[model samples]
Target: MSDHSNNNNSWHLSIVERKFLLLWCDFIIVFGAIFLAVILRSTISMDLFLQRGYFGIIFLYTSLTVAIFYIIDLYNIFLIDFWTSIVPRIFIGVALTSLLVIVSSFFLEFLALPRKSIVFMSVVIILGMMLTRYYLMIVKRYPLNIMVLGSGFAALKMIEDIKKSGSAYFHIIGIYDDDDRKHGKEVMEIPIRGGIESFAADIKELRPQMVVVSFEKEIKETWTDILLQCARSNVQVSSAVDIYCKLFGKVPSDHIDALWLLSGIQLIRKPYFIFKRFCDIIFSLIGLFIMLLIFPFVFVIMKITSPGPIFFSQVRVGLNGSHFRIHKFRTMVVDAEKRTGAVWATKGDNRITAFGKFMRKVRIDELPQCWNILKGDMSIVGPRPERPEFVDMLKERITFYDERHLVKPGLTGWAQVLYPYGNTIEDATEKLHYDLFYIRNMSVFMDMKIILKTIATVIGGRGGM
Candidate 1:
């Protein structure tokens, strides 16, 4: 077993190291942005020096953001999708810290912490940190040097996903399979280094960061020897499933298994459960209130465009594979799926009404799910609720399909925001990768990031199911 406790300088960090760096990174970015934002807002932007008391107030609020982030685990950088991850957490951090400023102003007489400065700092810090992370991505990117011990369709998919990840550090250096025909050939542009016998020496010489053992038993001896050597050499080792999860952010349906679930890697916890529950109550209430306010006008528009009920309800799988009726704004004609028998909605789904098409694109169709959140059948964030019929069929066809049911289903989730609408078994397989990552890495900070990305998705009108 690799001693996770060892203080090795390997690129693959331990869980503990990941946690530490996560907090440390957030601390640096949040405080630096605060200090810089304060200086810019007070002196350069406002053309006046900030009073000592007000400046002190700014510092305190900045410090509080560090704690707020700590509580939410915003610093867990390994699990974060930098571009999609940082801004939302920063917004939450700034929002919580800004409240501190407002409360501080009420108590202190001389130090009137300017509300405008705090708000401006929040936006600047968010934008600045987001850009900085992207820049780091470009400069400091370290591709995960991967050597696959296979030259097949599975290997091809693995290579393709690595290229799609946009990570500087994820690279498929070569492939190794004993197929005599493929021994000197290139599969999907990745060179086939040699047969199984050549693998150990090649790995030792190349010292690739990850060795993916996806070959069949026909070459067991060669693949095993190389895996043993790479493990001994302190190189990171993975399987097709492992790379799929790391790159695509979820375990694949085809590769999921009982052992994977029992591997002692649980992502949801007490804090996540409590925080998720609280969010359900608060955000759902706010969402419902807003819906009520906008209902009259929205209802009229739907009524004129289509003749049907405003709310659409469908039985969906919830926590622990339980079932509940998920609510959404009607986005299709009545009995649209009667003939197709639970088919996927396409880009220009003919079943969709005129208003429904617009609603689906903009995700207005999902707004009614806030009520489901309030009802405790769903959460603000988690795996997107799948229909009970689909879940039953998927569980039979897909491996580890039941793993997603370990936590409460969500209205919008890691899969929904990161992946486009899943319309086929292949698409669902891909989306499941993201869903697993969300379940394994569920945190308040992660949830917050998903919520922010959901906003961006809605604005772009490019995401839905």
Candidate 2:
């Protein structure tokens, strides 16, 4: 949810839902501008843009551009201030989309649109997108104005997330608690206001569209009565836990109690796993094809660089806590771990050869992982497989660490693509949060997104080690 929202764009909906609306809004604007350009240039009616002949090209362009935007992090809703940072990325994405179209035109005979039209369409899309983005930014049209009701740890975490999100569509009025010490205090610079003594009056005066309750312990029975009364008067009452899940894709680590872990049991969807395996087979073949093509070049480089085997295999933890040998183009010195046994890769580790660094940077080292996918040892998208040495330590030190193995391991995954290279227990814990989020929200669309994003991450030469 930090990166994307579901399709619903309602204000009362969580952070992800509203951002999903914003994403679609972005798609529409970009596509609309292209349609507008075609109409103005070719003198066609608006409906004509959707005609069979025109629609194919229109869909391709819009979809590619939007995908490029996502790859460049245009939809990272958690960024503190994105507008100032997004212009160059937007420019690069626009250029890349145009270049793709131009390149494809040589092979696809139907793509022979006039150069002027293409140029004009790009101009219109860029202008329209910019104008629309700025307009949305300047607008104060949030559908949800929520008042957080609590002064406990949960309340503080909720406040912290909301404050960090920089969401234009969500307004947090203030936190309310009954503790006398916090009645007039400020948390995150927002007034704590009055406690239970003035809760009803404050709600009435602020007229929040929703109330989120995150008290660590149950509030007074009288306060619950008042909350129910406020709900009856048209104010929505929502759980802080649910709101937290909506804002962040993962459950809050601190709030992962018994019920939360038990609730995750329902996420094991058999049908989805079947479909996911199908994807793994298809994509793994494609990856193997690419790997085969580059085999000779990599082989020669490996032979010339380090005195080691071209491929290396390591035992990694996989589904249901099973272990499998994972294959990768060797990117470390021969017997690199002989002295240290099993140690984490360090930043700029001297054990890595020049070719190894290049291979890791561009992710060519992972090409052999396609074999793992083909062999049913991993998925195309899921949690990254870890070594038994690390897994055992992680399980002992990190909460819910074993849950990642409940699903199939992956070649490139949510954790692999989203998080930086993790070399310590703390880093592993952060990656686990992202891994858990992926497991809970596993879907066809989400998998495709992770794959697409992995492509971008690889191309950017930046990703976890």
Candidate 3:
């Protein structure tokens, strides 16, 4: 119903734009909930609420609620098919926020604080979120007619992701490729629009808000010139990988090149590395203290059930091609690799004892790796450390395998949380895509997400070897 065809400003919605839009919505909802909570507590409650000098309490509660939602990834809401995705995030977001509030209430005692009012506010917030999202999906929506400029598999992948996610948000009008063989072929029900030799001309003709360049092979210089001209006129031009990452949450590993690495990964700064190291030590200490409290029980169960040492240690490759010994609570037979040296654990691996399986499922087995984090061989979050034997094999088989070692390895990593436990080279290849995405997008926000996901996975007893 809305046409952005001729708008030079473009109708492109980047991932950053979506995140900011949701953030603003959440801010309003949180403040509104706070205001309602105060009103619901009494007819006119400024006197009562301010009596205890708890003005800062509202600020604290609202800030913590929003922060928890972010930490639990309530903001990854997609407007397309918003119902199927947004509902659960809203429920989880509000529930987790409520839990945090209840836990904090123990430390901060507010006189005359109405517990019913707090609960009511959380419900209203959830209802407000649903309304906000429904309004977004149902009203004032515009779809961008976008075109892709290639016939390669990368281009095909982008088209598939868009069709799945971009419904009512992005409309793919056509695809253009120079290959005469594909001149008439259709992708995802969208017709191939032939060569983009005059990409600028095509822009004027079709009025596609964006042009995604998805050439699988080397880009011809002439096509590059045409794309630059289109961009010069303020037409939104992006790469297939850019769109792919937005849709799939991972980079296109097959289409990766040295140039992408240079552009995407140079954002890693010295302070980030320094601060990340500090977090690893601090969190590891907290983890180790908890592990100690539970250690005697786990140690006895591990030994009695498996008849192995309480702790398991193995040689793992770490940063800069160096190696370190990684420690974990024993989750396998003492000589798991004695017969079949350096083999990965499979789903029904006979070497895993009853206790070992449980440990792996709950991730109690990996707890000892906090020592590795303390010793600087690993970060709190990064690429999962692999055994040198597997690293050597994978490096020979996979592209850019050693690049993961550019940073310290992690006890739990991006790949581990996003992907299931990988037992085969194929699975590793898939995980590598996630790993590359993490490395490229490495930041405090990404690390927090990985931590949250890992917690969820462990709680659900998922991805055990």
Q: What value of lDDT does candidate 1 attain over all alpha carbons?
A: 0.69
| Candidate 2 structure, TM-score to reference | 0.76
Cα error of candidate 2 at position 448, Å: 2.2
Which is the winner by lDDT between candidate 2 and candidate 3? 3
Model 2 RMSD vs true structure: 6.8
For residues 93-131, write the lDDT of model 3, one tens digit per residue. Answer: 788776766677678654234778778878889988888
C-alpha RMSD in Å of predicted model 1 compared with the true structure: 7.2
Deviation in angstroms for 92 in model 3? Answer: 7.7
lDDT of 1 by residue, 1-465 (tens): 011122122345433454565556656666665666456544343323353455555556666777786775465443335645555566666678667656765786433446676667567766765665555444555334567877644556767765665554455667887777877776656778787667767665555666776764445664676577677766666677666665555665554556675553453457768877987999999988888887897799988988789888988899988889988889888888888898667877778888887777777678789988998988999888888888888888766778888888888888887777757887787777777777766776678778877887888777564
Best by lDDT: 3
Backbone clash pairs for candidate 3 read: none
Give the residue spans of candidate 3 off by over 4 A.
Answer: 1-31, 42-113, 135-144, 161-170, 196-209, 216-235
> Which candidate tops TM-score?
3
Clashing pairs in 2: 5-16, 177-195
Model 1 quality (TM-score): 0.69
What's the lDDT for all of these models?
0.69, 0.75, 0.76
Off by over 4 Å in 1: 1-144, 147-156, 164-168, 175-186, 192-240, 262-267, 334-343, 463-465
